[model samples]
Target: MSAENEIVPPPGAAHRFAVVGMGATGVGVFVALVRSLVAGGRAAGAEVHIFETKERLGAGVAYSTPHDCHLLNMRASTMSVHPDDPDHFVRWLSAHPGAGPAVESEYVPRRLFAEYLQEFFEEALVEARQCGIKVRTHKSVVSDCREDARGVHLIAGLDHFVFGRVFLCLGDLPSTAYLEFTKLPTYVHSMWQGAGLETIAPDATVGILGTSLTAVDALLQLRGAGHRGAITCFSRRRALPKVQGPSVRYTLRHVTEENLGRLTDGFTRQLEFAEVAELFRRELEDGLGLAIDWKRVLARPAETFTHTLARDVERAERGQTLWYSILDATSEIVPLVWRTMSAGARASFMTEHLSIWSMFRHCMPLDNARRLLGMATDGAFTVASELSAVSYDEEDAVFQVSAGGTTHRVRWLVNATGTGFALDCSDSSLIQNMLMRGDITPHPLGGIDVDFDSLRVLRRDGSHSARAHYIGPLTRGVHFYTNSFETNLANAHSAVAAALN
Candidate 1:
């Protein structure tokens, strides 16, 4: 059997699984599925295939950075890809005992994480060998998933292929949020892709449109690249993230790490956002025990509470108000909160709060990840509440942001505004064609719609079938908890169960 296309068939004696998007989540899914099959005493009767667009597995956009400076924000103590094996990465690090303390104890470079993932991938493949289960890796974009009375057709260009089961673990799409700011060469975008870096010179005055984790990575990458510019980042409020506690001694504390669970409550959010301004303020100021670490709150949602709270309010009253509350609480715990919202909720929340959320949550880290509150001595980057918009001065080689009714123009600009899943504007050709051909439809609220049980995409008439399955950020509308390590693992396990059952 060849390495890339090793499929053993003794008159359909083995089961098959093909997972798409070989990023961290996809790899986790593949490993979990193969691991299950390998352990089930039916390993020899299974065939698993992996497909990726970026040449290799493990490192997608997140870990694919070709730089040493870009390190994960989460410390070495908490960055394992496997939830069950918390120290899998720590153990991996122990292999090189003499690698040094700072590199060992602190957050190591993303490249190190990439290496760990690759190592795990190889280990899983080796283990699956005895069961005749092989991961056939195809280096091509999966264009669409077409289904008839039979199975599913994974279309990639003119080539037609088939997979018994498919999982879409597509990661972050292009940061085309501010497409309104066209015609400016200095408007650089994409912290991960590095697509807009070439348009800027050493001293090009720049303005980053949003302030999220992506913004933080971009700023660090720029400084590492020796970018000598007056880089003034603007959002709805210029709000930088609150630094992780314990780094510097604080006179007072808000939310501690222990119960990072409350951030997921829409009930709490609704009760908080009932009115404006102060109502929101008191909720966040409550306490650490009452609230949880922002990310943990995000990863583990208070869904029952949210559902109960949502039941009381009419659909119309729920959206912006509930969204504002979630956005306010989500400032410190963006990614995890992001993990919990349904694709529709994410689209709505992002649509309504993109400018506001970016202002408060997406902030540039400088001089040792200093919290913005520490440096706003004279209000250089202080908290301000306001509305903002984007307008272009094409000939001037600039893009302007009209925040609080003042048009601030910058030399270089790129639409770092983020992605639009309007079906037509997606970066994934597969997604675009899927929407175009009715293979998938947007959830009523927003994002790709799916059935509540199987996590499979729902058609236009809202019917559920087992032929198609989706995972990752796209299914935010259905699962609400897509793409986290847990979500990825759960989706894969569920997908495998659904397929095999």
Candidate 2:
């Protein structure tokens, strides 16, 4: 075996595992590990340690929001915590009618999802206990982690613990953009932070950065709170996310494992960008039974933002968005395709196609889109492209935002640009400390480096830590679709299997 893949004996108990950060990813890893231990006949006297600082164990930042307007992007049918069982979450929601309506194909409020995760986690804990497994929870942030000859050492504030294996599921990081105005009360660096949009006056003009889903959330929250001020979304492209349509299941033909195997000659070669694009083209064309206008699809629409949104809504209502269904069907194989691509191809996609790709892939719910359309029709919201500069005037207590060759002044500027992937700019001291100690290395494209198969974190010297595994959105560099719950859950299972093996 390669030196990096070598496994060492546990210093103490063999079944002791530690999961740092009890978000969705961390919860997945913990549950998978518990089930694996029980299935492998190792549950007797087995112990699992969970470390998190959040008030809610499994909610994390993504679903912790109490706003009903902040809806999940994906449908409930696909948001199962169990990768193998797609109906797990839906079943849970059915059992608890007070949580929210259980529409399997509909997008529910994120807070409802949070309740689902917490309840699922509670059930897992009960099952673990019944199986003679000891589950422990720590309400402290993990400040640092280091592996030595003994075991994996985790320092959480004043306390310290050791475990046979450690899974890092730190979730998404806050955006590091617009740091210069962080001290300004009017400039909100993160929309998820404490009392985010509530501080903005009802009549305050707002300028939100980026036209991603996060920006959509900000706008919806503002509207939900009865904000009557005009809001302008600023971004380089200013293209809003596509609206999700009816859930249609599609079987892939071109972007399948068999086709990929044939193209790579049994996994001997890296795939070129053009080759992958052609496969996608074939898949979309086959699904639609018509030729796709690549230029028209990729290019920014000439119509106004409201018109485009209305048209997308109409198309979605008519179920004419078969292409989106086709794209969604390829989610399972996306990581495999990404891993097989040459580095140049991956970098090229990140540089040129990531924005547009995200705009389509991470879409808003039809409900939210319709509400945004209403706001647009009321002349309270607009999107501007070609965003250049933004500066704050202390005397005037307003922000000057330059975009589309016009400068607009707003009372508040929000950095709704979404998650930041740069580790150097991470807000977590644990990640910062790990980087300083060479416990982890950053990926060239983004996030930290990890073994694509085992999810073991690779160190500065290119050696994989035997006891440390990272599975979260920050692993996007290794798995392109890590943002999705399904991908993260699958990764959690893989990491547990590797750790137990």
Candidate 3:
């Protein structure tokens, strides 16, 4: 471990690239790198490295979690590493003789997807090494990052990994942000806390603060664990994810490879919903000339950003006058609507547009949510809104909440308010460290303030990170549709292009 070989600052640091958080975004970037360098014949000459805190590379928090029963909102066929290779995943599934026949396109187990990604990266890494690309896997978290003329230097496990360019593939924060109910000990904080449902004793009354997919997962876990307790879920407006069912049109498979190259540009530039539907109808009839399943189209809006925006605009336009009512009534479509709003727009909309959301946004599932209602009607689980905690008497295991100024007392409360964001997070070592070192800055609650076009990191001081770029939720403010495979793939395509240049 001499000074020279002790992994000191290497030469040509500016030409190197270090990526943090090896989730889907990381996988996307890894594939993007191979595509770029291999295409340029510099694959072996390029230095690309990733620092991942997750137990394995390419399976950050999202996929790293060991929840198999929890199905992906998406089907396996759609989650491909290469945007151009539309059937990459489907083909992979088929090629894996052990995986069995082409069964129904149901939500695949999250673990299977994780393993698929793991295998994909391992193979890609081998290919990368064959081309002379240097791929380093550090099992540590990046506590901080600094930039100098040499480029971006990241502190991972006391070593400085310098890179000419950096891409952050970090996903959402740990669910513990909702520990507000636990400000007193009577509540359990961080639903991901060890089979979250197990915390509540059988027959004990507990409250959940969120109404999204996470909450549903927790509910399912609780029921599986045989907890006959009174469970209460609190959300300003809670919505259940739409179920998988029949569709009117097929999935939008372009936005990539062909870029619908076979189609016309007048085809998909919709900033609104009707325009999108019309484009799809026309494209299928005039170009591909077939009916696209409406169900599939709605379910897989993953690609069609223009269509998504148009849909949200349409949703908003219809409910403008009935704001709160619309949000309350259409509660089932939050995920879709949420996807459509830009990060900046989301922040602004979430704040001032509470009325719209309250009326239309949060929805309980008509069928699946019946499980929740059963719990409620049976007097075991109660769902409430506008809950406020009065105080906690930790010793006595009593927590109080006030809604509409009326305080309700409970033996315990669970803070399930949902994920913490940049604005709300101050103690995360990764984020705090990044902020302190001026390596990255949190954008206004809307997102990470990424240059929508370049995907470069916009510093807290209002400047782009000389070498760093952020992907995933960090870019939510700018891209709005980050964290999805489609968005990640798009980001990889765009940012890697910049890196190569």
Candidate 4:
């Protein structure tokens, strides 16, 4: 190894730590690791290496958007980096008045959250330095990682560095589902990649794939830019996300650890899908004080998209959606529920209820919902379900999208289908290389397999790595609730604790 790559510890330091990726997840790991080390009197002369190619460290892809139109789905009260302190983000917002308005119950722009994260990270760096911890940042992508006797090795470009422990906090991976159209000038595969939406002509028709939150973001951006084109959001189920209502504090009774433990016989038995469904049913009915009309909630409504949007907005405005509050309360125990489930149960949920579940669970803020309703009423765009197929016309330079038994031609096609979880199909060389070397294995449901409690990566041979821990959205299959910042932060603390132990 070269002199720079040598694992020589500083004069008083005995261990070196490396965090791959400087997104929100990475920032969480770094902060948690620093705090843990300082508390344990191990921070003196310790080295922390952060690897990322992005100009901004903590913004990541989700919060990196500069547009004010893209708002956070969660309210400000719950968007804190410290899991124990629910008001941490709100306090930060209070201190930084120039960032944006601070309303604990309101959904703020994502850029503001990005600023909070960057500031939080900077503060952590200051603390780390004061405690005699050496911080190093490598502005390069980690292409591969391998763990052996010496330590965990991270290969970034032509350079290699080994650390006593490595935390892989790489954020969401872009969807490769529509890679065929990637080369086409009219098709934008990843919406977050710079200035893709700005290239669209003001009057040209646009077709957006997937009606998830990302699709909502694209539509809002197009509208904010004063695009006069008719935009159509295409999806297989044709269902838009539910709108957020007034925040309500709910204490979980059904989906608690005690209940789960009893159901799983102290977690020795795997839970069936039906068992988990019953728990949710009971919880929802208990919260609403009435039996739920499951058929109505699950079935595709006969009402048009505009009608559904309006009704949901009205319900949200009235704060009559107690089910949402109840569901939100269950976020803490979702991963435990997922872990107790049998493999067959997990597979069944993924194939059967994933779409509808996502629509209800991952909701949009009321502000965006009202904006979408107005746009729909004004005939700016329409959401179409039953997306059958799509084809590109080379000579015409337009996309032909077939949905709901009608073919619509659009000059621009945007894929807002959200992040891809398939490891083998990932665009990241680091993930692909790790998979190839048997350092990690794909979870059957989604993401990479990991030890649930420790957050350590599980290899193809069914052994957990001692020095490597994986966190972020890629742990979705294992955690089932890894998308939220709070969950990722908690997981980071868990991973760092395990690493230190």
Please give each candidate's TM-score. Answer: 0.72, 0.96, 0.73, 0.96
Q: What is the lDDT of residue 113 in candidate 4?
A: 92
Local accuracy of candidate 3 as per-residue lDDT tens digits, 66-179: 654455655565577766686777777777754564324445556667778889888888888887888877888787777775567778877866778888777666544544
Q: Write the per-residue lDDT of candidate 1 for residues 1-501, one digit (tens) a residue.
A: 466575433343226667878888788777877877766766776777677878668898778886766666555555676766767677777785543454544567778787778888888888888668866778877877776634566776576766556677777666536654433445555655656566577687666765555555556666667677666555554344423322221221223222224443532332122122233344454522254355642332234322322222332232222323333333333333444444555556545644444433332223225322222332222221232776677677576766556666767754444444455556677787778778788865446876554667877666765667776666655554443445555666676666556
Candidate 2: tens digits of C-alpha lDDT, residues 124-197: 89989999999988998899999986688899989988788999999878886777888898888888887688
lDDT over C-alpha atoms for residue 277 of model 1:
29
Candidate 4, residue 327: Cα displacement in angstroms equals 0.4
Model 4 Cα lDDT, one tens digit per residue, 276-328: 99999999998888988899889998999999999999999999778889999
Off by over 4 Å in 1: 1-14, 96-99, 102-105, 180-189, 247-368, 371-387, 418-421, 481-483
The TM-score obtained by model 1 is 0.72
TM-score of 2: 0.96
The list of candidate 2 runs beyond 4 A from truth reads: 1-13, 99-105
Q: Highest lDDT: which candidate?
A: 4
User: How far off is residue 426 in model 4, in Å?
Assistant: 1.4
Order of the predicted models by TM-score, top scorer first: 4, 2, 3, 1
Q: Which candidate do you rate higher for TM-score, 1 or 2?
A: 2
Give the deviation of candidate 2 from the true structure as CA RMSD.
3.1
> How far does residue 231 in candidate 1 sit from its true spot (Å)?
1.2
Q: CA lDDT of 448 in candidate 2?
A: 88
**All models, RMSD in angstroms:** 10.7, 3.1, 9.5, 2.9
Model 4 spans with C-alpha error above 4 angstroms: 1-14, 100-105
TM-score between model 4 and native = 0.96
Q: How many clashes show up per model?
A: 24, 0, 41, 0
